[model samples]
Target: MSRHRTIFRRPILLCVDFDETITVHDTTSLLFQLSSSSASTQQQLVTQYVDEVGEFIGSYETKWRQRELISSRSRTFDDAGLHEFLEGYAAVDLRSVQRVVECRALEGIRHQDLVKVASSVQVRSNYAETLALADDWKIISVNWNKKLVESVITQAGVVHEPTQIIANDMKADQQGVTTGEINVKVQSPMDKARWIDNVRSMYAATKPTVVYVGDSATDLLALLAADVGIWIAAANTAASSAKLLHQLVENYGIDLHPLMNCGSVGGRIHNDRPVLYTVTDWAQVQSILKSPF
Candidate 1:
């Protein structure tokens, strides 16, 4: 459970990324494997979706790199058209793969198996254990499958409203296979921020503060859009959130501690940079939120 330092007087909306921010491994990848397809074939499809399609989901590369590649194809291409093409291609690929997986349905995987997968995979410590306490935190799944993300978190016994999770998904059968047409909601990183803004407008009267947490560059736009943006760098990895923020701060020439509401919030702002916070795990994040200690 997240340690409570002090009670919040205003509504707090946590806009979080689902892929690697909460779960240790990518649940989308795991969902693809459950249709009884061979491991190699599953990996091939996932690889194509990430590499040839979504620019590895903006992990090793940036969104600008994706635009550069697109611009190379046709300098005169329309921006809106390119965006649509990329998103459409991913949706088609994902649906096509789901169809193929359903055709096989030889795994005999039951819904119970999803719980096992959730347990087998190492979560970020108490991250899943502290969900309900987050109130209206939304899981912005940038990946292709929402059901898979929901399944893992649901199996964790973290009860949350349906509106809290935004992602793509397909209906599942008794065999634990995707048996319906895919529903694509969020296709790009920009969509994450856009959705949050939309949600904010819905609860505008409350004047909630949006706190976005994510792990990859795919979450760049949303993180920057929030009142408080957090980067959850992989543990012991060189791509620590602090390092990434340092780079962004240097590149954008922005200060850490902005002039407005500077010291009233939780966590410390080093040398007056951005109102950014970096924690090794979810527990620390909860700790930082409750108090400035």
Candidate 2:
């Protein structure tokens, strides 16, 4: 399943989104589970997260309708507009992180505690199999703690370790207790795109082909930045994450093409008309990446 750089003329760089993309469930709740807070306190934190996100979505929907009405006369997919639209989500995302800090939800949690919660996180079906095809693997996420992402992947029996993880760090004391202050780095879709470019730069000499697989709105920018973008709508979460993705695609008229065969990978960014391949499961991803596409 390994790729030979000499024969391929370039390496394969697989960048996957964490949370609902790789895992069966988003790890946001798992982060809270690390804290020894009473069940009621933990529920309060989770409820806050849900309320804020819901409010943001409500506002976003209003704006979405206005845009739809504005474009009713002539409708064509505006790739650049879609990029701008998703970038605006950064503020809401950052606000959520700030609220978590203010509430001290993660404070007092130890690193080892995170490892315990990570063990319960489940990887999507066939994800590890598809991951083995890459010359290098990286997890790009907006999740508050990087260690949780690493631990989850390690526990999932993934033999190929992630070369890099682009995510926020949880500040911890010498005694390993979380300070509740996140050293925020990745928060926006733009941030994800920037980090992916940083990773791609490391392989400038090889000119590796970059493939990004993601599931939510936060992953939109990074998906477009790669040579091949895969939107895996998890069966369990399709009603929410998948619906949001579909709404964005529909509202903006995105050029989403169904991936039918193995040789569907693009060579470079299709700026003129960006195309994102859609998939329902990791087995499809494995089939697509079994050979060069």
Cα RMSD of all models vs. native, in order, equals 8.3, 4.3
Give TM per candidate.
0.65, 0.86
Best by lDDT: 2
Q: Candidate 1 lDDT, tens digit per residue, 1-293?
A: 88968744666677888877887766665655555557776666556544544443343236445655655322232335334433554464556556445554324344555556666555676776445445468888766556556677776777777888888765567655555345567766567778878888977988877778887645766766777777676765555334443444333323343223344555423333434545557765574355421
Q: Whose TM-score is greatest here? A: 2
User: How many residue pairs clash per model?
Assistant: 8, 0
Q: Give Cα-based local distance difference scores for all models.
A: 0.59, 0.77
lDDT of 2 by residue, 71-148 (tens): 742156666667766765667667667777887777878888888878778778888778887787888888889888
Superposed Cα deviation of residue 161, candidate 1 (Å)? 1.9
